[model samples]
Target: MSILTIHPKDEAQETALKTILDGFAVRYEIEPDETEYLMSSKANEIALDKSIKQAEEGDVVKIALDDLWK
Candidate 1:
């Protein structure tokens, strides 16, 4: 099992990663960054903190298309 930390800005990239990983049955989790920063409402720092903490516990993975071919 592994955890992949991806910036939400590149959502398309993440989707591509999911597809490649799915083919191989590689377990993974997505860690989302703070979203309230973009909103005008109150901050959601707690959610951001929790996501970061979850990421720290799992193994990190870098998604590369070349890896899929190997």
Candidate 2:
């Protein structure tokens, strides 16, 4: 289970990416949650401090489709 952070600004792009992911013919799930640690991380931190400030600290869960096939 890998955690992938989707920046709020690239939401549209993320959605598009998800669409592409769906084409992979794999079973996956998206769970929405919230967290504060993202507020202090630099990994894939595509938003600015001021923008992150307004980030309601949330998460979108993605499970590997390969696991479901097993």
Candidate 3:
């Protein structure tokens, strides 16, 4: 058996796909969002936590708006 993972653009698309699948009696499972994958592992969770803490403490430097691309 093969499985297909889908990333819908918006809620409407997600609902439409679910509706189609349901109409066809296909079994499907809903998983967590992208953020869940970001912190899926312990090391990743720690790194994200540290980054969030730094941002909350205002330890980040601000770059000029025009210099963003350069």
Candidate 4:
């Protein structure tokens, strides 16, 4: 089985999507946004906090602006 990730454009679309899923009797699961998803795990939250702190301390590497596509 394959999983599908959907982002509803607005409340109306979200409601419509739910209605369609229900009508088709398709099973679906709702997931939290990225930040909340990561925070769901203690280890993930700790790692994210460390990464943020390091960035604030300028501990990240500097990359060339023109090399983004490379």
Ranking of candidates on lDDT, top first: 3, 4, 1, 2
> CA lDDT of each candidate?
0.67, 0.61, 0.96, 0.94
Q: Is candidate 2 or candidate 4 better by TM-score?
A: 4
Across residues 8-64, which tens digit of lDDT does each residue of candidate 2 receive? 457788688688778986455665544455545675354655456665454434569
- Between prediction 1 and prediction 3, the one with superior TM-score is 3
Report the Cα lDDT for candidate 4.
0.94
Residue 7, model 3, lDDT: 94
Ranking by TM-score: 3, 4, 1, 2
Q: Candidate 4 lDDT, tens digit per residue, 2-32?
A: 8898999998999999999999999999878
Question: 56, model 4: CA deviation in Å?
Answer: 2.5
Q: What ranges in model 2 sit over 4 Å off? A: 1-9, 35-70
The residue pairs found clashing in candidate 3 are: none
Report the lDDT tens digits of candidate 3 across residue range 6-27. Answer: 9999999999999999999999
Where model 3 places Cα greater than 4 Å from the true spot, the runs are 1-20, 26-31
TM-score of each: 0.38, 0.31, 0.58, 0.55
Show model 1 residue runs off by greater than 4 Å: 1-9, 36-70
Clashing residue pairs, backbone N/CA/C < 3 A, model 2: 33-59, 34-58
**For residue 51, what is the lDDT in candidate 1?**
62
What is the Cα-based lDDT of residue 39 in candidate 1?
A: 39
